[model samples]
Target: MDADRVNTHTDARSETIRSATLELAQELGFAKLSIEAVAARAGVGKHTIYRRWPSKGALFLDAVLSSHETILEYPDTGDIVADLREQILAAVELLARPPLDGLFRSLLGEAQQDAAISAALNERFIAPQTQRTIDRLEKARDAGQLSPDLDLELAMSILSGPIYFQFLITAQPLTHDYIDRLLAALFAGLGPRP
Candidate 1:
């Protein structure tokens, strides 16, 4: 086969493997997810998964991050409120979807006891989003939309904290209207004060 056809074939197979990993992880949780199970689910040989990812943790990280990227689109509209609203809405939607939601919940649950899993989850999934939020906040501050004294890292946490709290702790159903109202409240506090 030609190189283009070979590349396309590999890409399709990789996506299928990742999808199967998510499905299996959703049902089996991270600790119980095995290469053999994913291979069976994807209808591919176990060597395919092993060739792509050396270990279960690496495969799970790829699957979780791939699912996250497919679902969440962090906005960079230059207007902090618009960007934040977009980000929060995407996250809320992600939490409501059963497949992605189960993947994340499983990762978080396993991260508590497994250091490798915790590192992978934080590095691959959480840190990048937080970094993007920081970059956006810095731009807003530079544009004079935010106070220069603002701490971007803390600001990122503050911006994302409520949605996560509602999702994980309160178990509240996230609606568009709810996110709008929540953003209003958060922006009010983050806004310039006399």
Candidate 2:
């Protein structure tokens, strides 16, 4: 096969595998999801999956993250607040829905016990998303929408921390109102000056 044909074939197989993984994960939940099942569903051999991913966790990570790749991206609409709100709302909506919510929770649980999974999750998903948010914040700061001295990393954390806390720790509903309140507080600051 020519290089182009080979690349196309490879991409098709990868997409098939990722789709099967997601379907199986949604049906069986991540705890019961296995590479064997995914291979069978994808009509590919177990070796095919193993060749691409070292472990089930790695494959699961890729499948889940890839499924929501576009939603995870930050928008640049000039109005940083509106752009951030749109992106955050999309993220929260994903987390609030079926399959992704359960899948993400399972991934987080697995990451806590597996160092490889933890590192991969941070490196592949968390770090990149965090950097994207920081890059947007930097633009806002440069444009004078955000305070020039504001630590972008901290700002990113500040924006995400409450959402994660509600999602993972408190199990509260991640409503649009909740996000509005969070953003309001973030931009408004707290208390009277001393």
Candidate 3:
């Protein structure tokens, strides 16, 4: 077979495996997912998954992060508050969905006990998303919507932490009113203290 054809075939297979991982993880939850199960679902050998990812956590991280990346567009509408509000609302809506909600709970529970899983979750999912948010904050800073000295990473945490807390810890409903209140509080504190 030609090299380009071979590459395309490989890419297709990788995507299939990732899709299978996402489905299995969503259905079975992260704690219950296994390489054998994923391999069976993907119609690939166990060795194939092992060759791509050394552990179940890594595979789950890849699948979940890739799925999230496809859906989460970086909102840059020039108005920083509107951009952040829209982005946070999208995240709340997405993460609060059925399978994803359970999947996140399972992954986070497992990650706490497994150092490798924790690292993979942070590196693959959390860090990338945070970095993207920071990039947006940087753009806002450049536009004079935010302070140039603002800690962009911390700002991301300030924006997302409450949502995660409500979802995972408080078990509170993330209603539109709650989102508005959250943003209001954040903007009150995070905006320039004139």
Candidate 4:
């Protein structure tokens, strides 16, 4: 009968509904996803969901993001070579994880047609991750580990592109050896011209 208890109950129910929506969104493509289905799955009324999220698009966007794992940390070990290698390995490892792979592909697929979703993904996810890597490379450049002219954005593509290429291209599953080769080849090109 109290406001605090009511708010707590409401918050818990909202989280349950949100998670159920994400599960459904992942299994059934976002376009086909419905709030009615989510409410049914969550054991909540349809009106409850509408109150929490105004539209299916908002629900799908929130679900996609909540289901995604946080980006891996970028570390500075003083040696740029070591740090870059670590970054490559971290990225490949993330792509290799199955749930992340599915969610990532789903997000990317959705972004192609939805400008709002695309902007959200870039801002909430990609841009911050890219900026962290870029900052690390800049530190390396300052320390004289890499060329002073290293283009951070291009440098990120250099690190990420091949892993995506393999993951998207080959039907083969990800493996450590495969990841090693991808990062090795990437560094071979990106490393200071020897």
The best candidate by TM-score is: 2
The number of clashing residue pairs in each candidate reads: 0, 0, 0, 0
Better of 1 and 2 by lDDT: 2
| RMSD to native, candidate 4 | 6.4
Please list all clashing residue pairs in model 2, or write none if there are none: none
RMSD of each: 5.8, 4.5, 5.2, 6.4
Q: Write the per-residue lDDT of candidate 4 for residues 1-194, one digit (tens) a residue.
A: 12221122236787798788877876775667888899999999999877655556656655655544354667777977667667666665654555446655666676777666566656655677788878888888888877677687797777766666666766466676776676566646745775
> Per-residue lDDT for 53-132 in model 1, tens only?
75676677776666567555557777888887887777766655565665666656666776766676566667878887
TM-scores of the candidates are: 0.76, 0.90, 0.83, 0.69
CA lDDT of each candidate? 0.72, 0.83, 0.76, 0.67
Model 3, span 1-194: residue lDDT tens: 12221121237887899899888887777768899998999999999877777678767766776667645667778998888888877777677767687787777777888777777766656777888888988988999988678877697678888888888899888898998888788766755677
TM-score of 3: 0.83
Which candidate gets the maximum lDDT versus the true structure? 2
- Which pairs clash in model 3? none
TM-score of 1: 0.76
Candidates 1 and 3 compared: the better one by lDDT is 3
User: Candidate 2 or 4, higher lDDT?
Assistant: 2
Per-residue lDDT over 14-128 for candidate 2, one digit per residue giving the tens place of the 0 to 100 score:
9999899999999999999999999999999999887777778878887877777678788898998899899999887786667589888888889888877787777777888
* Ordering by TM-score: 2, 3, 1, 4
Off by over 4 Å in 3: 1-10, 147-149, 190-194
Kindly give the stretch of ten consecutive residues in candidate 2 with the minimal lDDT sum. Answer: 1-10
C-alpha lDDT (0 to 100) for residue 140 of candidate 1: 84
